[model samples]
Target: MGELDRAIADYDQIIELNPRGPSVYFYRGIVNARKDDHDRAVADYTQAMQLAHQDQRGSGDRKAQLQGQADDPAYASSADGQSIALASGDGIALRARGGAYAAKGDFDRAIADYDEAIRLNPRDKEAISARGNAYKTKGDFDRAIADYDQAAQLDARDARVYFHRARVYWQMASLAKSLTDLDQAIQLNPKNAYPVLWREIVARRSDQLSEAAKQLDATKWPAPIINLFLGTMTPEQVRSAADDADPVKKKGQVCEANFYVAERALQSGAKEEALKLFDLAAADCPKTFIEKQAADVELGLLRASR
Candidate 1:
């Protein structure tokens, strides 16, 4: 906040001295961009580019570069001799434009600009990361993965790259890859809860019940959510598991009691009660077994009625 204020103050002074100066406006535009005022940033950048073009119209190197006759100064300090004074080698202008376009959801422009930035600086990991993120947002998982891969190769230690890659993998339904990337992200930044949540979802989807349960226990996950899974035990299975439990068993006894109630309801020809039990079984039973039990009960009822 303090930095932004200082930057704004500096921009104000520069703007006052050179009311039509592109460089001053460009500096201010950066501050607006940081604040997420993208519209104003775009306006400022446009104006800056125009002013730079006018400044460069007759200059030998700058004009030649604009005319495609020569290379633009890769590192020009003078805002006075070019339409845009952004460092050519670093592709700062292209990257900034790409980011601004992305902010506005103009992905085509963003990608084009990013392409230019990448061409200018093959090692611009920030541009690579931004482009990857843009592709992810556009639901182009393959492109996102490509960009993320390059970004990761450029800077393997960046946790954000791993996180974005995981998201792309998840979107592609590549569960193993998604989980692997998520685990890497977590290892790199354990404080981020996002990877943990994604990992939990993956665990559930994979039917790793014990692992999911342990994660829930270890992480202080909500009890109700855990119960949502456990509560799926069928009344019959609950009862059977409970009734045969040794005296040393605690939860099994309670499960058995619920099972008895469920079984009794089914025996009483209460279809709703039976279905409820089946639902509980679906939720609580092992993925390999519970699904069959639920399906069989449902199929039996359907066929009997027919």
Candidate 2:
């Protein structure tokens, strides 16, 4: 956190030195977004877009000055390269601001931004994937899948797209399809623990516990929580592993731990206990965590069924 604060301070100095530099504002916006300061991130991204637009217009002497700077060996090798770089920067700014909007739950606005970013750079796999996420959040599953399909075609090796698409499949109750995508994602990026964790849940939900247990044995996941998932660690032990000094961290850990335990309880016919754990997870977990999102979804279905 201190490092991020110092980085922001440095960006401020750079902005002061080059007030018209869009890249500095864009980078600062990224930092602010990471800190969950969405409003500031939006403001900085807006400033970046405006600057990028002004740069694009080839404003009087500004274009000539930029071209001259490009001639410097320290900058770009040629003016054309610099122009391409500047144009790409605008697309990046749009996509980044779209992400901030998505984080704020303004899916409509986020989709609009992602659309424009894609228009500016048709080959932007990240923009396409982001648009899919916004569509998923809006419960437009078909459109989300379409975007994910396009993203996959654009970059077949991107594990994140597969992971996200798997989530949408899970939400759609296409457990078999979700499992396939999750399997592909894990195969592509074995080091990413998130896919492994979700795969275990999905496998169990699909009544493939034997397969899940086999896969779990072959893959080594980190920490007390993985032990909880394997039924080797108690809920109390999982809770103990959470950092007590940090309320937010503790809440996130406890939320995730309770969510997994709730799943186990549900499987064991302890419906009442499962409901209690789900309620605690939904109430205490950070909204940004995937576990909280799943918890909320589960709770909604539970209430609907009742």
Stretches of candidate 2 off by over 4 Å are 56-89, 205-222, 244-255, 283-288
lDDT of each: 0.57, 0.72
What are the per-residue Cα lDDT tens digits for candidate 2 across 122-192?
88787888888778877899999999999899889989889989989999999999989998898887666
Best by lDDT: 2
TM-score, structure 2 vs. true: 0.79
**Estimated TM-score for each candidate:** 0.53, 0.79
Best by TM-score: 2
Per-residue accuracy of model 1 over 1-306 as CA lDDT, tens digit each: 326668888778878888765556666666666555667766776676666657744334443343352233322311111123233532555666666677666778778877987887688787787778777766677888999999899889888788778866765679899889988887787655445545655554424333444444433323222333355544444444454323323332443243334434554577677566555553444221212233344535635775
Please identify model 1 stretches exceeding 4 Å from their true place. Answer: 2-10, 19-23, 49-90, 204-306
Residue pairs clashing, model 2: none
